[model samples]
Target chain A: MSENSTYAEITEAIRAHDSFILLSHIRPDGDAIGSQLALGHALEAMGKTVHYINEDGLPDNLSFMAESQRIQTPPAEPLDVQVCIALDCATKPRLGENALHAASKAKLWINIDHHISNPAYGDLNHIDSTSPATGQILYQLIKSADMPLPDATRDAIYVAVSTDTGSFQYSNTTAATYEMAADLVRRGLDVGTINAQIYDSNPYRKIELLRSLLNTLQLENDGKVAHWELPYSVKEEYNLKPEDSEDQIDLIRGIDGVVAAAFFEELEDGKIRVSLRAKDDTFNACETAQLFGGGGHARAAGIRMAGPISDAREKVLAAISNAIS
Target chain B: MSENSTYAEITEAIRAHDSFILLSHIRPDGDAIGSQLALGHALEAMGKTVHYINEDGLPDNLSFMAESQRIQTPPAEPLDVQVCIALDCATKPRLGENALHAASKAKLWINIDHHISNPAYGDLNHIDSTSPATGQILYQLIKSADMPLPDATRDAIYVAVSTDTGSFQYSNTTAATYEMAADLVRRGLDVGTINAQIYDSNPYRKIELLRSLLNTLQLENDGKVAHWELPYSVKEEYNLKPEDSEDQIDLIRGIDGVVAAAFFEELEDGKIRVSLRAKDDTFNACETAQLFGGGGHARAAGIRMAGPISDAREKVLAAISNAIS
Candidate 1:
């Protein structure tokens, strides 16, 4: 009924339908989990049945969310949801294998995200790149639904926004971000404790992995570009999962004189996952990821290549060098 | 005179003295700068002429302190100071070359610090190991002096206390620490802006270096220890100075299972400066640093070894292996 039929319209679609399913991107980050869980909480608060699914397991760091365990891989039963909402995912294919199928099967599909690269695959798309995180858009949608947010919902939304914006330190943080944070804070969310748990609470093994990474640092092109790689053996020795190395790339990128930093993790499948961070305006890692059929923000980005480690390294270096030159 | 003679006695010594100088230990951290500057500010407020000397140059990151520019290296000026007060230094030898000379020349010598290992080298030593940082002691001393604290003095004191206790997240943070911080906040110090400036303002070059470090990560000793090194050539190419790598050791120490993280930086002199951080209760990097005649706290420590890279690596690894085994 509303003239502005994007987010509000999507909310109505979700309410009008009974059972709902939520999905996010492959190798999901905070925004994906945040948008998924926040919407799920909102739907459940409204007395609607909702199921959240992600093919990849929840990242260890984000496992603290209340409904994290409820997020399943996929339902064995055929997609029975009247409506399905894909949150914080760009392309439909990014939903991995299971959720992608569910998205196709649902009678009404709604897409909600903040990614500029969103493919708009759903029957209804409500994407606002201006929002700092998908959680912000979901907050607006929840408000429009005339439902009061509970404490659990507030916690999830706060984390969703906080993690995506790098704890309000990144450039993406805007006035809206602060307003949303203040709102969440007012809802009995302890920002300081949450920040400590998210950023400060680190297990010992992750520290070891970081030390190993720093040991092999290399710089090129007059220190304008920095690169490092972790072989598969190192992961096995350290008993380190991919998630354990999540924040390592940022450490190297913080060195003085480094314009860009690239980290290579040799996967068991003979593929290399490259995490890139750009420190200066002269380099854009997202564009670099795009060249390899991947994309992310300018400051942080990644690409996955299935090939020999050396070959993938050479290719990535060539692409980055060419871009800088 | 107050019954607590230690603080009053120290304040009077500083006030009565003409041509006074202050010094801190080598590789001074926030506590060192904070204590030095707070004392300097207090002395200036009380109409006493004061000179501060740090033989080593000021760290680039802490240049925001008001007295950072006033910090002087000892020159050929005759040693006319009636007294020298060493703040936050464990031992007289820890004072760098020039400050050491100044300390020896003063008519009266005093040592004020919070290190448990302090040698009590000064003629008048006020060492309180229970105190979180020397800034706390200086706060008491300033209060006892009944000198009005200016905004700059409050800022310097706050920086010292904040950084030393890891922004109130570390184990060293206590009720006393909070009380001091609360008082500083009451004096109109913007805690958020200070924290943002100290922790959030990352240089582009630093991010690039972080990326490089992350790329080369390795996990050793069954994930208990993570080791990484940055060679001088790489640092030179990246235009990164030694100070830029300050937090690399801490980043590695944050891994999920890692107990210890060691970052080895190859100095221009071909010496490797190993910075260590411990995440677990079992491992102590400071003890490891002590094996090489360096010292620090249990969680964080450092050592400088002069040798061929391979030899130094082997020695350091052997020491670490011994510690864990």
Candidate 2:
């Protein structure tokens, strides 16, 4: 086992177990999928039976990862592996029910993540809040373990780090992020190709949906907050899939003088899905999301509520107003 | 002098001079401003009197750089400097007449740039086409001279590198780009704050103009081309200055299924300003811009036209159709 790994115990467990299963959060993002696939490839190289599983499956945007096909959406049969490792999920609930049950069959549960708010819920937890992405932490572990960082591992980690750090544009990016990115490029990651596919390859339908959403843009509290509502009907009208609305909140947040931005999606079951993005803790997205039984980082957070979008809009705006005022 | 610098003679000239004038291209961008300011400060540290000159002066957004106050817009006095350096301007015409006459008055004329198309219209030229931004090359020069790089220099270089590289998201970004950015961040550049002000601080008027522009979006040749025409009237109608329409073309270029995008703006003189953006040289933006006597990089390019908005739009679309066909 590598000495640099804070979780040498986790590596020892991996060595002891001949088989393993990897799981990530529901509605898997780049960090979740990248970490899962990177770790899975490393373990598989050791002749271990590695199953990379996600409950909600891969999002449409991250389809470019080299090992994307390896990500399974919870196979029909129950898992029976010796060791289970959860990557990027902050809590058991984040894994959703079925993936949790499948992973529970394993004797050892290892959790690895980089979220500041992680609860460290696993038989062995190695959470480095300082890391901008879980794949970053995994990179160090792979380097320390003397594991071969084949192109697949490097590509997956590149996706994880770039998306998590907004292509190294976010505040979380450090000297280490750039330092690591340089190493990944040397290890056969085509930075340009990966960036183009992950970011620039938007389907036309998404822009069509965006056209209508931008029309719905409204400002509140003296333009300190910007938001738009997307009813379930808009999705049906535009033939939009779930991922079509991804990052639409940025359009609102990118507007000048907007301290906070929110995206409201009306679910079919008379429920509303709200994602909040704030410039900083002054707006407190996490606290606002917590009021609705959802949570996330201070800059970005979300919640689900049983109400009409109009009602949710009224409520969330009030919360944001209170947070900032 | 740094062994890495090809223009050691340029540095020698700098060390030999007591008074200098630095000129950048018209409608100066962050690179023009940043390189000029960084080098100007370095020259001033050597107790040289330096005048940073630009025809149109600094963009409103980069007011954060410490030396912005020193940027002069076509100062009344003629140049009396011992040495003159052109920063980031590719050709004499790029200096827009006034600065060229000013720069020509110096005893020695030097050109420092990263453009491949530079004509080397100076007594000494230092052109590194492989370097993504002129600032990247200048950093080595500053380091070689053993000049003190204060926060101002670091921030200015960051602006130059980041804006030219599209915040390090462009294809030109390499291991060295990140390496240099890391060094800058360590040298007191607040990457997050600087990035937010330079990028995230768009005035609401721009989005207002974008709203109307998106409404005008139309697809041609099976959506291979996406375009919108902004009759210069919109600027006056929206109470917008010229710079407000900057980066507006990206909104059209960012749309999916568009191989090439164009923004047709009617100039005050009835001629149109045509800017073309394409994914690759196969759609050749420079070639398209050149069709109307405009020139720029392969990916992004611009030109001014002598025709009605409708005629230029039709002609450009036909040319784009021909180029891709």
Candidate 3:
């Protein structure tokens, strides 16, 4: 159990270890699952035994990736692995109980993540907050260490970075991101096919949710703040999953002359889920979220509060108006 | 007019010319205006007098670029210049009559574009249809010729290619497109700021249009073909301009099970403007468009046919269902 590990140290550990298990955050995203597969595939290419496990297994949307089936639920018993690697997880507990129990047998622990909030709980940590996605960090690590990059690793890396960066639309995207994508394309990654799968494939429920949300959309504070609400009834009517409404707030946030956008949704548990997005640094979404004991980044943040959707919307809109003013 | 010209030949023309006028097609988009600005700024940096003129002028969305102010409407009198370079236009007349008149005084005509249908209607033509955008072509020509890349040219090139490639998500996006973007970022492009301006800024009217379109959305052929109609009445009610409804068809096109999507808009002159987008090569949008005497590429095409909107939708949807089947 040492301190922070360099790319060389990480690579050396990979070379030295015989068996490994990889885990990412629960309710896995492209970065979470993609990071594990990318580094896992690279290790497998080097003739190392690697197991990929996630608390929630893989989401239905990510089933398009041919090798995503490698990510499975943790077995009933802990596996006989010498080293355990945690990727794209901000904290140890976020990996879920079953995943941790499955990795308990590993003698050594390695943590690789890009979240600034990560506590470096692993025995050996490689935390790079400046990197937009853990996938980007793995790409740098693999390239720096000259790891064997299989086609699985190549496409996985692109999806991981591309999704985390909002298909390279987010402000966090860097020159290295584009450079990495360019290299991946040169390595035979089909940008069109992958991008279509990632962006164009939307469930019909999502559109129904969008139509419902738009019906509830409103402008306030002289059109500088735009907000919308979704009652639990609409969710029931559409039989919508939580992921169905993901990023739907962008519809209002994208409106010109609006500096801030807010989405208020009523949860079945009698709580309101609030998502806030700011267009610029002038208004801090995290700060506004913090006012309600929630947290996130400058431009995007989330909150959960007691609701009757109307009351929740009023309180949040007031805070947003105050912040932007 | 001479036949096809090489990169070297186009460079030689630029070097030889003292005064130049740049023009693109009417209803200029980011690629059209961006290509003009990118090459115009480069030539201006090389001590050449450059006049930036377009028939329809810059769209409001693209005005965020600082150098975009240079893209002006064609003046009544023809410009006195040694050369006129038409960028991103497929046909000569697409540049509009006013733009052609403005360029009438130029002795040499140089056409640089990425559209495959472009006729070689210039004294020198550099048409690389394989390139995704005219901006990518300009970036390559500038870098290959070792021309000075001013900040304006660098930013302009990024926007040109980004918008044309749907932020590099389209099938036409190439490895070189990503490479060019990487180069622009390295040369001090603030990708976050520019991208926000390009993507996040949408007028409220656009959202209104989306709401109206969504209400009319329908899925036919067992959800394989999705179609939506926009009646002329809704346009009048929303006080909408044509640009407000641009790309709205993508909402339906992106549905998970949809193989092809169509948008039927009732125009003021008893015409229905139909835009068809296919998800894969199996559904040839151009072929279907040609059935109604319209044409475009394999994946995306358009047709303007006589309509009551119902008849147009029925005809187009059937064609799409047949194509997909």
Please tell me which predicted candidate would have the highest lDDT against the true structure: 3
For model 3 the local lDDT of residue B75 reads 97
TM-score of each: 0.62, 0.91, 0.93
Report per-candidate DockQ: 0.12, 0.59, 0.78
Chain B TM-score for each model? 0.82, 0.83, 0.94
The 0-to-1 C-alpha lDDT of every candidate, in the order given, reads 0.76, 0.82, 0.90
Q: Write the per-residue lDDT of candidate 1 for residues A155-245, one digit (tens) a residue.
A: 7887888777665545566555656665665566765566666677676656557657767677787767778888899999988866788
Q: After superposition, how far is residue B262 of candidate 1 from its true place, in Å?
A: 11
Candidates in order: C-alpha RMSD to true structure? 8.3, 3.5, 2.6
In terms of DockQ, which candidate is strongest?
3
Error of 1 at A140 (Å): 3.7
Q: What are the runs in model 1 whose C-alpha is more than 4 Å off?
A: A1-6, A143-146, A201-208, A233-239, B1-58, B64-325
Q: Tell me how large the interface RMSD of candidate 1 is.
A: 8.2
Models sorted by DockQ, best on top:
3, 2, 1
**Worst 10-residue lDDT window, candidate 1 chain A:** A1-10
What fraction of the reference interface contacts is present in each model, in order? 0.17, 0.60, 0.83
Please, what are the lDDT tens digits per residue for candidate 2 over residues B1-325? Answer: 1122355677787888799999988988889999998888878877889988888877788887886988977756577888888889888898877776766668887888988888787778888888889888889788876776877788888889989987777778778888888888777677667776677776778777777777778889997899987877787888888878777777667777687999988888888888899965569999888888899988999989887988888889999999999
In model 1, the number of clashes is 47
Please state the CAPRI-style docking class of candidate 2.
Answer: medium
